[model samples]
Target chain A: MKAALGVMALAAALVLIGKAERPETGWSFRLPPGFPRPRVPADNPMSSAKVELGRRLFYDVRLSGNGTQSCASCHVQSRAFTDGLANAVGSTGEIHRRSSMSLTNIGYASHLTWANPLVDGLEAQALAPMFGDAPTELGLESAAQLEARLAGDKTLQGLAQEAFGAGGLTLDRVLKALAAFERTLISGRSPYDRYVGGEVSALSPEAQRGLELFFSERTECFHCHGGFNFTDAFGHEGAEPERKFHNNGLYDLGAGAYPKRDQGLIEHSGRPEDMGRFKAPTLRNIDVTAPYMHDGSLATLDAVIRHYEAGGRGGEANPRRDRFIRGFILTDEERSDLIAFLESLTDPEFLADPRFGAP
Target chain B: MRSLLLSLALTALPACRQDTSAASLSTHRLRFIATLDGAAANCKSLAAPPFRLRDARLFVSELRVIGPDGETPAAFVPDSRFQSVEVALLDFEDATEGCEGDSAEHTELVFEAPVSSVRAVTFTVGIPFALNHQNPALARAPLTAGAMHWGWRGGYKFVRIEAQRDGVEGRIHLGSTGCEGALHAITSCAHPNRGTVHLELDPATQQVALDLGAFFGSDKGGDKTDCMGEPADPSCHAGYRAIGAAGKEAARQSDSLAANTTNPAMGASAFTVIRRTP
Candidate 1:
């Protein structure tokens, strides 16, 4: 009996030592020196198992209702996680209200969906694409159907269990896993990051000038999109909490409304003054995520800068435009330089990283 | 070994006993009922003229209870317990489903509370100032669900009263006004329509009734207004003003109902309270 007890103790110690010595197999993420990791929920703790499961799910077409589209369908990694569509088309052939936003550094986003205040966390935002009836993507409203769909694949079941203990069959667990995977999709190794990190040769002369213009108070680009992440409203681990929204005067069709289909935050609040307000997206890979804004009306980065330079859509036509959007004209050289600066934000390492791509 | 186990058990006993005592002292049940007492207004559609309350749904949140003894300042408690109270909408019965011209009925909001230790209870007609100032991410329960959780508006709706009035069915939704951008600036934003009301938790008068008639009747000229649709319309603006006035009056009456037993307030007198069998 004494010998058996000794053996048991030895095995337990070995297990502990093995756990301690376990090499980190997953991606190694580190926020910029001055930056911080975005706030993550306690319920969905980050782990390598969960992140791997999320990555697989993100690329899997079976996640959609018709098994035709995956998160990757709209968010291609080559394009910096944004499909260059004017507006994303869901699996059901329904056009989305807005363009597909770039997933680069999305973990720091305060508000998940465009113009939606209710959805704050990535776990909660997963519900919009999975179960939202109006623009159904995954169509996992019925638990039974979701269970049946997931049950067909042994690999998915194993991944789900590995990520979410024994009770990993639920929709909430799936979403939590997906969110965990998305949070790992960090891209901070861009040329801009290198420049910020004191590397002199990181940016060319023209790109440096564009960067100066971006941070300059004259252009006022930093007012909306500030901080290391280039977004004013960002929340992350150990970072000061900030969740701001703005009305850059997207449009004032008439009668204190933006447009018929997309009224932004005004429809939710039922306030007249809240018209044309939308959350400012991260400009980490602005060159890739084309068709900007909530409606995806703008097609290219040049067009987007022109829109801002003109002060907003209908700047000369509409009188009720936001006061901040006093149309300013930029020189032709300045426009090219701004585009170059935006291109500098692209992390070549992220786009070429095998971890983000399919096996 | 036995002695050590016994000592640990004995030491843990006090904590369990203290928990029971604390729970016993702070668990009281309270019920909030909004009674609709008026003939339903016949309306064709939500946008049509003479938009009346054919069918209406009311969503209220930020529920709180204020004790008459005044021990607790107007803080937001999960359950109604003492001199301070504030509660907002969580959910409501859809009024649009009912037949037009039917006599409206009362909807009961029943929840468990520990209010025996408190003197009086007061509640905000809308969400509390603190909760309103918080990010929508922080708001859980009652406030998170229903129409009150308007995305990006920065605050919950104080009152969502939908009614079909005079052949025009429309909603009268009231939230914090003066929203500039997507992010609600707590200091800059204004909720002119928001007000507070108090309820005296007397064993004699346990039940309270909130009437919808006064809200509709208060705005005499803005009869054809609809605050739900076409928010920029003059009629809608006038209707909002009328509703805002009525909410203030109702709050004043509710506050008075807590203090005076014999002389009930305008809407308080109509309420019938029944004691639960002990």
Candidate 2:
């Protein structure tokens, strides 16, 4: 009896130590210099198996309602995971008011979408494109049909079970896998990134001058788009979720209200003050994600810069424009230089990496 | 030495087997349901008075009861997946059972404690401030699964009641007001604004029915369903009246039932009542 009790004590100690140990073993990620690890939910710990399964599901056209589109369809890896469309067309052929957001470095984002404050993590945000009925994207919220679609394929089912550990083909497991895979989409090997590190020579002389103007108080561009990720809204383990939203003077349809249908955060809050507020997406791979803003009304990056140059394009000078968005005159050389600095944010390696490509 | 250790281990094992207090335990599975106009509530009726419940989610915490053995707080019977000490969220809208939007048939708040000597049960309507602002990734079930959380700055919605009367949507979203703090943690809130409900009954043989009909005074399908934490707003009339009757509007203390007094919690008793089983 005594021997058994002693063994039990040792086993208990081992179990306790295991519980305290870091969940990230093969899940560990070495983020770029100054970049922090993204916060992983306690319930859904990061694992290689889960991410591997997610990568497969992300590329599988069968995951869609009609089996015609995958997440990779709208989010092409070569274009930095952006669809490069003025307005995102849903899998059901519904034209969305906004463009598809780039998935590059989305793991660090605290606020996931253009405006909906309720959507914070990648797990919940995936539900929108997957199941939203108003403008159905993938249209796979119904579990029975989704399971039936993936049922015959033994390989996909095997991967699902391994990722979820016994919950055979459930929505929760699907969501967790997708979230885990997205968290691994880290992009920090750009020219700007090298300059941020020790190598100041990574950037050209013109680009370096443009960088000063971008971060300088004169342009006031860094107010909303600051930090290493180039967005004020960021979150990591142990740190608070910086859920920041802003109206960058994109629309001014008189009375400070944006276009009726495209009035960003105000649609949820119903407050005039919150009219055109939307999440400022990270500029990690801004070159490919053109036709910007919440509504994707601005056709080109040059048009976007010019909009800011004139302060809140379209209609009269809106009252709801952000305080930092004061119209400034830029010379042709200065304008081209600003564009050059934005171009430096593109991570070519991330776009070409076969790891993120369709399986 | 081995024998001594074996005896000790056996003794401790039995003692540690039970997590709660070392008292006589009686497990009671409580069922919570709502009624409309003194009848069983239905949100799917399509006639002149459509009884179709579009959405209804209630968040109640700090549950305590005065039992035959005195008073003790009721701790939720923790499941293998999630557990909590003080708060309980009772969901009544399951999609199949006439509910339009939701899918879960989770209408009961289940909690266990030694309550054989119990005479009455008490609970609050909203989340406590201590746990409200904590990291959501770390919080369990009701805090996580439910759509109660209203972003970092705004905090959780105490009671999210959305119903359609004659195809019109009426919503009441109750939450903490004058809250100022960081995104993750709200350090302080001027008005906790939570409603307390304490009912006199025995769980072993009786049931409790909360009449929401009294709460929805004149549900004319108007936009009076939304309450943005304002006391004077017309949309909050039903909600304010219901919360007011549950406790002493002046004092948030569980003991302040305010049975005889005007519920100082909100204003008028709106449409609120506590029915007991014989």
Candidate 3:
């Protein structure tokens, strides 16, 4: 009996040790330089089968209630996953309140949506576009409906079996697969990245000057839109989650109110002081993800720069505006240099990569 | 491990026996019906030919039975997918006619209160701020229903009533607006937007009439405006007033016109106790 108990104790210890270390096999991430491994939820572990299945589902229109749209409808690949619309038009032709955000390095986002701080997980965030009815993106009503639509497809079923370990197609499985695939969308091969990697000739002289201006105290561009992912709201394995929203002084109807239709973080926070505050989206693919701002109000990089230089459209009167957005005069040459720097951050290879493309 | 198991077993005993403490509490079922011009309206009755009821679902919270002794909070039983101890979703659409989704019609609020002569009923017409702004993906029961989840707002729609007339659709989607903070740790809401409702109940049948006509307003056949609780939208004035959201900033938004004209305090008149004939 003592020997049997000793064997059981050893087995338990081995299991605990195995779990404490990094996963040895099954699915491993080919993370880029200066990038930490993303924090994957234990419930939905990383798997190659799940990623493949999610790639298929991400582009499948049958996942929608009307069979007219899918996740890809608004999140196009070449455009850094943004539809390039001022407002994202839903599958049912309903216009969304906010612009479609870029999915570039979305796995690193601490909070999922443009403003909702509680939507910290990609699995939970997937439900918004899939089943959300306010401006119905995918417009799917129920999981039963989704299951019924994909039930006949043998390819999805086989993939689901391999991905989920013998379970038939499920909504939970679908979400996990999508999140798994999204975690693999790492873009760290831009000119800026190359420059930081010690390649002196990666960026032009003008772009290097622009980079200095961006990080300078005058522009203060690097405060919210800083760090590896270029957005303060970044998280990873064992990293502290930063859920930050800022008011770039987009509008002030009377007080610090934004457009009534979409008032940024204030709509979620419900605080008077939080008016017009919105998450600073990553500048990773900002060149491709325009017109800028929450509403896509800025038409081009030049306009966005000018808006920032002028201390936002609301002017200095806006009390709730982020202090970093204080006005600064930028010469025409300096302006183009900054734009060059922003453009250099765009990874052309990542955009055209078939891995993220439709199957 | 044996001592730990014994302590856990000791803790579990009270939870299992806790149900017995509520044995004296009597179950009270309140029937709520949608009415148009004082007539009971359903999806079957209000098809596409006339004014079609697209959807009508409201969250009733903080329900209490006002008796002679005092007010006692109604302990809502986990009877259906439409109810929970924290809040109850009173759905009026059966997903027929003009209704959009697969929503089962549920228009009852059943709760357990002490056995006493109930004098009146009081409840809020929306969800509490705490329960309203959480992640709906992780919500349970009636909160799990997809049709009521307002993702962009980071909260559940407190009240959703949609109707179509003469090819024009009118909507009243109410939720907490100008809210501050993250989802789980929301600090405050500028406009709670909840309507306070109180009514004297009949001793026999506790039936309440949800006057849809009042919600749509007396104006019929003309252009009916929608209100998503935007302060700038003047269309929200009548609907907010009828729901008795009056003095709250939720309704005070359209009251920008109040500077010029005198407007009476809005009372919660959308719901009223009906005396049923035997």
Candidate 4:
């Protein structure tokens, strides 16, 4: 019995020694050329173990209260993290008012979701889908319920232990892990990116013309959907977070109103000037994450171009429309060229990357 | 852990009241109750035809007690979950039947005030501007409650009165509207939506009564839909009128609370003060 106890003690010491030798590797981003390091919260630093655990949780259906769906259900990786639906459907079959936003370079966004200005951090934003009841996404009733579900699974608990160092699985830890993984969904390898990287043949002549139109003052597409991430609502390590919302004049119920249910920034601010203001989503992977607009009212890229060309549904009569959204005439050839340029923004390699996929 | 903290708070209350120094600070407890036309009502027994209460909660702040001399600021005693120095949350729903958030039932506002005969009281039914737009994930209790949060708009509902009448659900969520600015640098909210209530109460008043009938009443030809506190929402007229915070130009554009529908000639208060028998 004494020999058996001695052997057990020896085994414990060996395990401790093995753990001490196998140090955790520090995480570093293989950022695309010209891309800056994404801004991370001071509380949640990046780690390989945490990101791996987050990837597993991101695809785990048990995260939902009913265990019917996961984050991947609405944010499918192949479709640039959007479900390609007009409105997102929750785990319990409740239809959401807004569409699923693409996760492509979401870490760079100064704000999260379609319109909320306050939700800037990914950790804070993760709480909405997991426990938000206004058309519940993950449909979790409470944090205790989520904790119980996560603690019940041995594999998940082991992963949590690795990521968070023997601390029990918790909501804050889960959110941090999920956010760490989401930050790694960097997409900057499109044909447009290649063209910018000195690859002259990366873009066709038609796409090149479309790109010019997109950047030109006539279309003014680059005004909002500009910069490396193709959006004005961008932030990085040393940059002051940009908060820009515009009214594209999608609808005019009466007196420059866009649907009563969703009046964009006005719904939050209650200011008359903010009637139809909405964030211009990153144009990266915009070709796949359709239907377009805040409410997903527009069907295709052609329809979007037409809406912009016509100066929105209300035309010049829309009092709340952005100054940049003035009427512009685009030829059929120019329109098709613009669509081709948007398609060029799609990064096939990033879409098919196994690193961002379910573990 | 929650119940233990609550018991600690309850235990601390009696000790505070035991202080007998002349003209010194003493704890004043004001219990709140929901009523269907002056009759006590809750999630379990709301009304006939079965009115299912989903959520009923409101934030009360800037509390002051009216004395013979003047108004005295009644500072809320900081509690573990619901009461803070600046604000107090009165949650009625018990997470039974249709109720879907925190099961903790909080319906009292305990505050420290100078010992005096309280004849009336005044307070605002809304979240303070400073704490309104803060990140809820990092917020302390009462503010951290998910059901009370208006996530899409980035604020807490100042007043949430939700129920189903004959299987048809109608919800009234009142919060600041036209709120502009980033999380930290909030410029301003166009419609602050903070309802100011001044009630005349007897010294024996034990409960602050909220009339659900007045809240659910529709002045616009019985169009009882969900009111998300949007100025464009015609459905909000009834709620705003009931809360005595409605303005003629509110639906269009006006930030004047003086132009509210609460007329002096009506002689009606936003909330009625009553004494509930133990």
lDDT of 3 by residue, A158-276 (tens): 99999887868877788889999998888878987777766758989898788878877899897988777778898777777888999998887866778767777665545677788
Candidate 1 Cα outliers beyond 4 Å, as residue runs: A1-34, A254-256, A314-323, B1-278
DockQ of each: 0.05, 0.04, 0.28, 0.31
Cα-based lDDT for every prediction: 0.56, 0.65, 0.75, 0.75
**Taking the tens digit of each residue's C-alpha lDDT, what string does model 2 give over B178-213?**
454443545555455677666667665556565665
Candidate 1's residue-wise lDDT over B1-278, tens digit each?
A: 32343234334444322222322224334444434442222222232433333333333333334333223322233432111233423323333443221233324443222233544554334554445544433344444322343333445555555555555444555555544334333443423344344456653346444444444444543455445322343434433333233334324322111221111112222123444323
Q: Candidate 2, what DockQ?
A: 0.04
**What does candidate 1's lDDT look like per residue over A241-312, in tens digits?**
565667786776764457756877666555666677778888888887787887888888898888889887
Between which residue pairs do clashes occur in model 4? A268-B179, A269-B177, A269-B178, A269-B179, A270-B178
Model 4 deviation from native, Cα RMSD in Å: 12.2
Task: Please state what fraction of the native interface contacts candidate 1 reproduces.
Answer: 0.03
- In order of listing, the candidates' clash counts read 50, 18, 8, 5
Chain B global fold similarity (TM-score) for predicted model 2 against the true chain B: 0.74
How does residue B169 of candidate 1 score in lDDT?
43
DockQ-based CAPRI category assigned to the predicted complex of candidate 3: acceptable
TM-score of 2: 0.62
lDDT of 4 at A223: 82
What is the TM-score of each candidate's chain B when compared with the real chain B?
A: 0.53, 0.74, 0.81, 0.80
Score candidate 2 by lDDT.
0.65
